[model samples]
Target chain A: MIRIEDLDFSYGRDGFRLTVPKLEVAAGEKVAWIGPSGSGKTTLLNLTAGIVSPDHGRIVVSGEELSALGDARRRDFRVRRIGMVFQEFELLDYLDVLDNILLPYRINDSLTLGPEVIERARALAEGVEIGDKLHRDVQKLSRGEQQRVALCRAVLTGPDVILADEPTGNLDPSNKERVLDILFRYADEHEATLVMVTHDRDLLPRFERVLDFDELCTPAPAPAQEARA
Target chain B: MSDSLYLAWRYMRHHKLKTAILIGSVTLILYLPLALQVLVDRATEQLSARARSTPLIVGARGSAVELALSTLYFESRSPAPIRMAEVERIRATGLAAPIPMHVRFRVRNQRIVGTTLDYFDFRGLRVGRGRPLAKLGECVLGAAAAAALQAGPGDRVNSSSEALFDLAGVYPLRMRVVGVLERTHGPDDEAVFVDIKTAWIIEGLGHGHQDLASVGAEGRVLERKDGRIVANASVVQYTEITAENEDSFHFHGDRSGFPLTAILALPPDDKSKTLLLGRYLGRDETSQVLEPVAVMEELVGTVARVRSWVIAAVVLVTLATALTMVLVFWLSLRLRRRELETMARIGCSRRTVASLVVCEIAVVFAFSVVLAGALTGVTSLYGPSLIRGLIL
Candidate 1:
C-alpha cells in the first residue's frame, strides 16, 4: 500500500499550490487522476515519483517512508522500486531503443541483470511492436513507437508502482486504446499499483477510482490524497 | 574494454567526425615539440662528437669559428691557404699530429677532401669496399660521396673547376676511385678523400706536361731548361695524370710555399694542447689556432638559447590549443544536457553520468596521445637521413 498525509506543495508562493490531508491506495488498485490544464495533476504525479518532495508532507510507498531518506537514498529508492513514464517521453537520443529499455538496470547496481532479464526486455520490445526497431535510434522512431519504447522502459523492471504522467496524451485514439490496454495488463499481471494522469475522460471508466484535481477548493466525500497508484 | 569504455567508444563512434578532428588537432600540436626535441638532440650529438674529436685547428688569421668549421667539417670556401712550411713548423712542435687539408674544390658537387691517411685513422674511418688511398690521384670515397656519385672501385670521377673565366685556371683532373669507406654518420661520410699531392695537381702547382721545348728541329728529345719546365703558352699541360705520363708530373715551386687550406692538430695530452695554444696566443695576424669543441660549444649554446624561446612558444601554443579544446568540450556537454537529464531519470547517479561524460573525453585524449607517439616514432626513424642529406 501507498499512503500520503497532509501534503502541501506549490510552485512558489505566487504560483499554483496543492494540498491534500490524507489518502491511501490499496496494493493493487488502479487509480486515475483527471483534470483540466494547470490542475497540478503532473506535479502530483511527480511528487509520487519522488522527483519533487512536498513542502510539508510525508509519503510512504510500499511501506517505505520517502521523507525520511536523504536525497541520494530517495533517488536510489526511486530507481530500485518505482518506475515513471514522463509526459514528454524523455527518451535519451544517443541510445537505441533496447538500451533505453535496459537503462534502469544499467545504472542501478542494486538490480542484478541476468539472461532472463535480457529475454524479458526482448519480449517487451516484441509485445510493443518495436522488436524490429530495438537497435534503431530512438529519435528516428515515430511518436507512437517512441511512446511504446517509453512504456516498455517503465515496466521493464517490473517496479512496485508505475507513475505515468499523461502516458497516452499524444497518441491517436486507436494507439491510445492499445497503449492503455498494454499498461493495464502489465499492472494487473504484476499485481502492482498503477497511478495514471490523463486528460482523456474516455479512459476513466476502466479505472477503479478517479480523482478530480479541480475540486481542490471544496471538501469532497472522496479521498483527499492521491497516493502511489 | 570496460563497460564505461565500451559506452565511451560507442559514443565516440556515434560522433566520428568530432572525435577525429579533436584527435588530429591534438596529435599535430603534440608532435611539434616532440619532433623538434628529437631532431635537435640528434643534430647536437652529431655536431658535438665531431667537434670533441677534433681538438685544435691551425689556419691563417681569420674567424676561429670558420677555421674550426673548415678543418672539422670541410665546409670552408676560399680559406686562406697556409703553407706546408707552417704545417711542418707545427708538426715539429712534438706536441701534435698535424694533418694538412686542402679542400677547395668539388667533384660532382660533393667535397673533395685532400689529406693523408692519418685523416682516416683520426676520424675512425675504415675501408668498406676496395682499398684505402695508396697512391696520388687514387681516391677513396666516403659512404655518402660514393652513393652520390654512384662510382666505386674501378670507376672514375672528375674534379669540377673553381673558376670558369680565369685563363690560367687549373685544369680539372680525373681521379680513379680506389675504394669506398664505411659510413661514419659524420661530415667525412659525405667527402671524397684524396692524397694532398692530388689536390696540388688540381691547383696547377703540380701538373703533367709535355716536353715541348725538348722537341728539337730534328724532332728529337733534348734536355729541358730550368725555366722551360714552367708551364707556358707552348707547354701542353695534361688535364689528367696517368701511369704513362705519371713521371712528367712535377711541382715548380719550393716546398715551403705549398698551398694548404688548414691543419688539423690532435694533441696527445692537455700539456701539448696548452703548449700549442700558448704558441699561437700572441701571433694574431700570422695565424690562429682554435679548439673545435670550444667553437661548437659557443655555437650550440647560442642556438640553444633561441631554442628555449621556441620551446616556450610551443608550450604557449599547446596550452592555448588545449584550452580551446576544453571550451569546445564544455559547450558540447551543455548541448547534451537533456541527454544527461534523460540518463539521470533512468536511474543514473549524478556521479555515474559525470563518469560517462569524462570517459568520452579521456578516450579522445588517450587516442590522441597514441597518435602523437606514433608520429614521433616515424619521424625519429627517418629524420636523421633527411637532415644528413641537407647539411652533410
Candidate 2:
C-alpha cells in the first residue's frame, strides 16, 4: 500500500512545482495514472519510488514513510521493498538478461530469496515470452522485448510495490497490450501493488482503477472554442 | 566480488584504447626512476671496486683526483711525468713494494700501459693467449681491446699520439702482441700492456733518431744509412728494440730526467704504509703521496648526498604521477554520470560502482609494474657491454 497527501516538489529555485493531493492505493491494487503532457505524473511516480523527495508533503510506501528516512536508509528501503520499471528500460548493457533480473537480490544481502527466486524469475520470463533471451545481452533485444524484460525484472523479487513510468511508451499496439497483461497479471497473482503512468487510452480498461491526473493536478486552460466566445 | 571483477574486466576489454593509454603512462613513470636508480647503483659499485683494489697511486704533485682517475680509471688528461729517481726512492724504503707505471701512450685508441712483469702478478691477470710482456717491445692486449682491434698474439700494433693531436711529434713504434689478458671486468679490459722501455721510446725519450749530425758524428752515419735525417723528416718511425739495442733506451742524462708518469705502491703492512706516508708528508715540495681509497671515499660521500636528493625527487614524482592517475580515473567515473545512474536504477549500488573503478586501476598498475621490472632486468644485464661499445 502507498499514500501521498498534498505532495509538492520542485527542481530548483523559481522553478515550477508539482502538486499532488490525497492519492492512495491498497495492497494488490492495480492502478494506471492517465494524464496529458505536463500533468506531473512521472514526478509523482519518482517520488513514490523514493528517487526524489517531496518538498512540502509526506509519502508512504508499504507503511514506511520515505520522506523521514535519510538518503542511505531510503536507498536500502527502496531496494528491499519497491521495484522500479523505468521508461527508458535502463538495463545495463554489459550484463545479460538473467543478471539484470537477479541484480536486486545481489545488492541487498538481507533479502533471502532462495533457489525458488530463480525459478520464479524463469517462470516470469516464460510468461513474458522472453525465456529464450535469458542469456542474451539486453542491448540486442527489440523495444518490445526490452519492455517485457523490464516488467519481469520489476516483479522478480516479489517486492510489495512496483512503480512503472510509461512502461510501454515505445512499443507497438499488440506488444503494448501483451506487456500490460503480463504486468497486471503478475502483480495480482503475487498480491503486489502496481502503479503505472501512461497516456494510452486503449489499454485503460484493463486496470481495476484509473486516476485521472488532470483532475489531481492544476487544471489546464479552457479549449479554444470555449475561450473564443 | 566476483561479479564486480567480471564487470570490471568486461569494461576494460570493451574500452581497449583507454586502458592501454593508462597503462602506458604508468609504465613510463615507473621505468624512468627504476632505470636511473639501477645505473647510479652500478656506477657507485664500479667506483668503489676500483678504489679498494688499488692501494696507493704515486703521481706528480698536481690534481690528485685527475691522477687517480687517469692511473686507476683510465680517464682524464695525462699528468706531468715523474722521474725514475722518485720511483727508486719509494722502492728503496723497503716499507712498500712499488710497481712503476708509465701510461703516456696508447695503441689504436686503447691505453698502452708500461709496467713491470710484477704488474700482471699483482693484478692477478691471466693470459688467455700466448704469454705475458716478458721482453721489451712485447705487448699484451686486454680481451676487449684485442677484439676491437681484431688483433691476436704474433700480430703488431703501433702507438698513436701521446698527446691529443701531436702528429708532427708522432713516433711510430711497433709492438709485438705477445698475449691477450682474460676479461677482468675492470679498467684493465680496455688497455694494452708493454714494458716500461716501450713507453719511453713512444715518448721520443730513448733510441729515437733526432738529427744525427746535430747529436754527434757517430749518429750522422747511422741517419745517412737509414736514408733520412730525423729533423728533416716530417715523421720518425722507430723499429722494435731487440737484444742489440736494449741498453740504448736508457737515459743519457741523469736517471731523474727519465719520464715516469705514476708509481703504484703495495705497502708491506699497515705500519709501513704509515711510515711511507709520513716520509712523503715530511718532504718540502714538488710531490705528494696519497691513498686513492681515502680520496675516493671522500668523493663518494659528496656524491651520495646529491644522489639521495635526486632519488628522493624521483620517488616524489612517481607518487605524484600515481595520484594523478587515480584522480583521472575518478574523474572518468564521474563523467559517466548518466550511464551510472541508469545502472543504479536497475540494481547496482554505489559500492559496486566504486569497486569497478578501483579494479580497473589495479589492473593497469599491476601490468605496468611487471613491464617496468622486466625492462629494468634486461637493461641491467646488457648495460655494461653497451657502455663499453660506446666508450671504446
Candidate 3:
C-alpha cells in the first residue's frame, strides 16, 4: 500500500519534474508504470521507497509518512517494509546469491534471520530456478539469472510493498513471461502490493492498474530562489 | 562483527593477490624496526653475558674495545702480543687465576685457539663427544668448527700455512681432533682448542726434528747434515706429532717471553678483582688489565649510537612505506566507489560502507603485527650465532 498526494519533485537545473495530485495503490494490487525514458517512472519508485525525499509531497508507504522519519529511520523503514529491484540488478559481486538475498537482514538488526528464514530463502531461490546457484557469486550469473536473483531478493524479506524498476528489461520474451508469473504469484501469495516500471506496452495488460507517466509529469520547474546571506 | 565487516572479509578473501601484496607491504614495514630492536637487544645481552663470565683480560696496551673484541671474541689478534711472563706474574699474586690465550692460526677458517685445560674448565666448556686435548698434537673442535670442518674425533686438520714460498716458515701442523665441544652458543663454538704449547709450535717458537737415531731410518729422515752428528739432508722434520715426536715438542726460547694474545683472569672475590685492577691500573704501557664487562659496556655504548642511526633509518622507511600504502589504498577505495554506492543503495548506511573499509585495513594491520612477531621470535632464536658470524 503506497499513497502519494501533491507530489512535486525535481532533479537538477535542466532535469525532469514530476507532479501527482493524488495516487493510491490498494493492498495486493499489481500496478505497472509505463512511460518513455526519463519520464520520472524510476524516480517515482525511488521517492516511494524513501531513497530520495520529495520536494513538496506527502508519501505514505506501508502506513508510515516519509517526511515524518529522519534519514536513517527512513532507510531502516525501506530495508524492513519495502523491497526494491533496480534496473541494473545492483548485486554485490563479492557475495553469493543467497547472501545478496539475505542482505536486508544483514544490514538491519531489527530483522532477525533464523533457520526458518534461511529455509524460506532457499524456497524462494528454488522458485526463481537459482537454487543450485545459492552459493555462487552473482557476478558469474547471466543477465537473466541476475534479474531472477534480484526479484527473489526483493520478495525474500516478505515486505508489504515491492517496487521494481525495469525488472524485465533484459529478459527474453518467454523468460519475461515466466518472471511476471512468478512475481505476481509470489506477491499474491504474500498479499503484498507491487509497483513495477516498464517500457513495454504489451506487459501493461497483466497489471490491474497501468499508470502512464506522461499524465503525471510536467515541464521542468524554475530553479529555486538563491538563499540570502 | 557487523555484516559490513563480514562483507569486507569476503572481499579480501576473494581478491587474494591484492590482499597478499598489501599484507606483505605492511609486514615488511613493521618487521624492520622490530627486527633491529630485537637483534640489538639480543647482541647486547649476549655481549654482556660473555663479559660477565670473563671478568678481566690482561692484554697489551691498546684500544680497550679492541682488547675486548680480540680477547672475548677471539677475533683480531692483539697488535702487541703480551709476554707469557705476565700470566706467570698474575698467577704468582694469588689474587686470580690467569688463563693464557694464543690465537695466531686458523684451520679451515676456524680459529685455532691454543689455551690450557684450565681455560675449558674456567669457561665451562664441556665436550659433547670424545675426550679433551690430552696430547701435544691432540685438538678439540668447537661445535660450529666441527660442523664447518665436518670432522669427528678421529679426523685431523692441518694448520693453515702462513708463508707459501718460505721453505722454513712454520710448517702446517697436522693436529688430530680428539673431541668436539658442546654448543656453548659463544665464540668458543667457532674455535678449535689445543694446548698453548701447540700454539707455540704452530708459531715456530717450538718445533720437532728427526731424532739422532732416525738420521737414516728408512731414508725418510731429511735435515741439515754436517760436522759430528749434525742434522743433514737425512734428518726430517715431523709435521704430525706422534707419541714419539710429541716428547720432543719443547719451547726453545725463554719460555716466559713467549707471546700470548691475552690472559683471562678469574678473581676470587670483589677484593681480589680490586687488587688485580689496582696492581696494573697506572702501568698502561706494558699491559692493560681491563674489566671485560666495563669495556664491553663502552663497546655497547658505541653500538647504541649505531642503533640510533638504524632506528632513524627505520623511521624514514616506515613513513615512506606508510605513505605509499595510504596512497594505494585510497586510490583503491576510490575505484570501489561504485560498489560502495551499491551497498548504500541497498539500505546499508553510509557509515556501514566506511566501516567496512576501515575494518579491512584493521585486518591487514593485525596480520602484519603477527607476522612481525613471528619474525622477531625466529631472529631471537638465532641471535647469538648471527652475532658470532658478524663480529667474530
Candidate 4:
C-alpha cells in the first residue's frame, strides 16, 4: 500500500537532513515505527500522509507518487486516500464527534459511501468505548476520549491506510491498551494498512513488524583526519 | 459550501463582540453618506421648486437666490425695501402682471408677508379659515404658524420683525388674526398673511403711537386737561398717516437709489423677456437683472460638482473600510493556524477554508446594510425639520 525509496527532508537550508533509504508496507499490514524523541518518526509519518513533501526520491501511496503532485492535487489525494491521526488528538473543537467522523465525506461530496459507512463509524465509536460521546463536542471530552475519537475519524472513511502519530501518547495504561486494540482491530476488519509512529515499547508486540530508528537511519561518518595521521 | 457556511456561522456566534464591532463600523460608513445624500437632494428639490414657481421676484438689488428665497420662500435676512414706484413702472410696461410683497413682520417664528390680494390669487392660495387679509391690521396665519402659536381666528397676537425675540429693536405690533391658510407643504405653511398697509404700519410708516409727553421740571409727564389724561389725543402728529408720509415711502430722490435686491420678471413672450432684460441690464450702474432659473441652474451645477466629490469620497471610504475589514479577517484566519490545520486534516479543502472567511464577512456586511438603510430612512424623513431647526 505504501513505499519510500531514498527519501530525504529538511526543515530549512541550514538544517540537518532526515533520510529514509528504503521502506515498504504491503496492503493490510499493521506496522509500527518505534524510536526515541527527535528520531524523525513523526517526519516519516508526515511524509507518508502527504502533509509535507520529501526533498528527494519517491513516496508512493496506493500507486500515487505524492512528490510529483501539485499542491491542490496533493491535498485532494490526501483527503481521498490517506487518513491521519495526531498524538494531540487534533479534532475540531467546534464540531461534535459524529460530525468530526463524517467530515471527509462532507468535503469531497463525491465519496458515495452508503448508510453502512455511518453504521461502521458508530460501531467503531462503540468499539473504542466513546459511543456516548458521539453527539458531544470534542472539546468536552477528556484526553483519552479525544484520542479515541481521533482514531475513529481516521479510519471512518474506509481509506486504504491510516497514519497515526503516537495515537495513544497521552492515554493511561488501560486506556492506551484499549485504544491500540480498537485501532488494530478496525484495521484488520477493514483490511486497511496501519502505520503508527510511537515511542511506547509495550506496543511493539502488537504490530507484525517494528522499524526501529537505528535500523531506518543512515550511520554518521567517522572523523577523517585521525586515520590520515 | 454548506460546511463553509456552517463553520462561518459558528465562528460569528463564538465571537459576538467582534462581529458587532465590525457591523457597527460598516453601518456608520454607509449611514453618514446616505443621510447626507438625502438632505442635499431634498434641499435642492425645495430650492428648485420655489425658483420654478415664481415667474418674477422683484426685490432690492442683491443675490437672486436670496431674493427668490425671501420673496418666494420667505427665507433669509430681510431685503432692502424697494419702492411701490418699481411696481408701478413694471405695471405700466404691460408685459406681465405684477404683485408686490412686503415682508416686514413675524408672528412667533413665522414670517408675516403683507402683499396685495393679487399675491394670493396669483399663487392660487386658499384659506382654511374665515377669510383672507382683506382689512388692515387683520391677518391670516399659515397652518404651521397657527399650530405652532396655538392661535385661531379672532385672536390677537403680537408680531416681531425677527423669527425669534429681538427685544433691543422695535416693540411687537399687535395684530388680529382673521384667517388661516391651508397647508401647502412649502414656505407658505410657515408664514402669516396681512395687507401691505399693515406691513407699512409695522415698518413705522403709518398710524400707530406717538410720544404724548414733553420733558418738564420733573422729567416727563402726560399733558392734562380738566384733570383728565388727555394729551394730543386727537391731534395729527408723527403717528398719523398722511399723503406726505406716503410719498416718503416712494423713493424718487434717486431712481437708481431705490433699494431692491432683484426683480422677478415674467415677460409676455420670449421676445418681451429679452427686451425687458436688455432694457434693465446695463441700463444702471448699481443694479442688474438676472434670470432666477439660469442662476439656479448654475448653482445646481456647482452643487453637483461638490456632490460628486463627496460621493466619490464616500465610495472610496467605503471601499477602504471593506478592504480593511477583509484584511483584518484574513489576518485572523492566519492566526487560527492550529484550528484551521485541524479542520484541514479532517478532510476540509482549502476552498472551504476560504469560503468560511468570506461567508463571515458577508453576514456582517448584510446586517450592516440593513441597519444603515434604516438609519438613513429615519434621517431622510426628518432631515428638513432638523436642518431648519439648526439654521433658525
> Of the candidates shown, which would achieve the greatest DockQ relative to the real structure?
3
**Model 2 residue pairs with clashes:** none
Please give the C-alpha DockQ score of model 3.
0.50
- Where does candidate 2 stray beyond 4 Å? A1-16, A22-38, A55-211, A217-229, B1-42, B83-87, B102-261, B282-285, B308-327, B353-392
Mind giving the per-residue lDDT tens digits that candidate 3 earns over A1-229? 8889999887764666778888999989999988766566777888898888888989998899986678788877887778788778888787899988887777665677788888988999998899999999899998888888888878877889988888787788987897788889988898999999998888999999998877866535333452100
Residue A166 error for model 2, in Å? 4.2
Tens-digit lDDT string for candidate 4 (A1-229): 9999999887666554578889999988999988666667776777787778899989999999998887677777777787788888877766789877776765654454468878888887888788887899788888888888888777776778888888888889988998888788878887888998888888889999998977897523323321100
- lDDT of candidate model 3 versus the reference: 0.83
Regions more than 4 Å wrong, model 4:
A11-14, A25-31, A56-70, A91-102, A109-155, A168-191, A200-210, A219-229, B20-46, B83-93, B99-268, B271-290, B308-326, B353-392
Which has the better lDDT: candidate 1, or candidate 2? 1
Error of 4 at A151 (Å): 4.7
Highest TM-score: which candidate? Answer: 3
Clashes of each: 1, 0, 9, 10
Native contacts conserved, per model: 0.34, 0.24, 0.46, 0.38
- Flag regions of model 3 displaced more than 4 Å: A11-17, A172-174, A219-229, B155-158, B162-174, B207-212, B218-252, B278-284, B387-392
**CAPRI quality of model 1:** acceptable
RMSD of each: 6.0, 7.7, 4.1, 8.3
Worst 10 residues of 2 chain B by lDDT: B229-238
| Tens digits of lDDT, candidate 2, B234-330 | 4333466656555444444665668777888889788988888888775565767789888777766766676789779988988998898878787
- In order of lDDT, best first, we have 3, 1, 2, 4
Rank by TM-score, descending? 3, 1, 4, 2
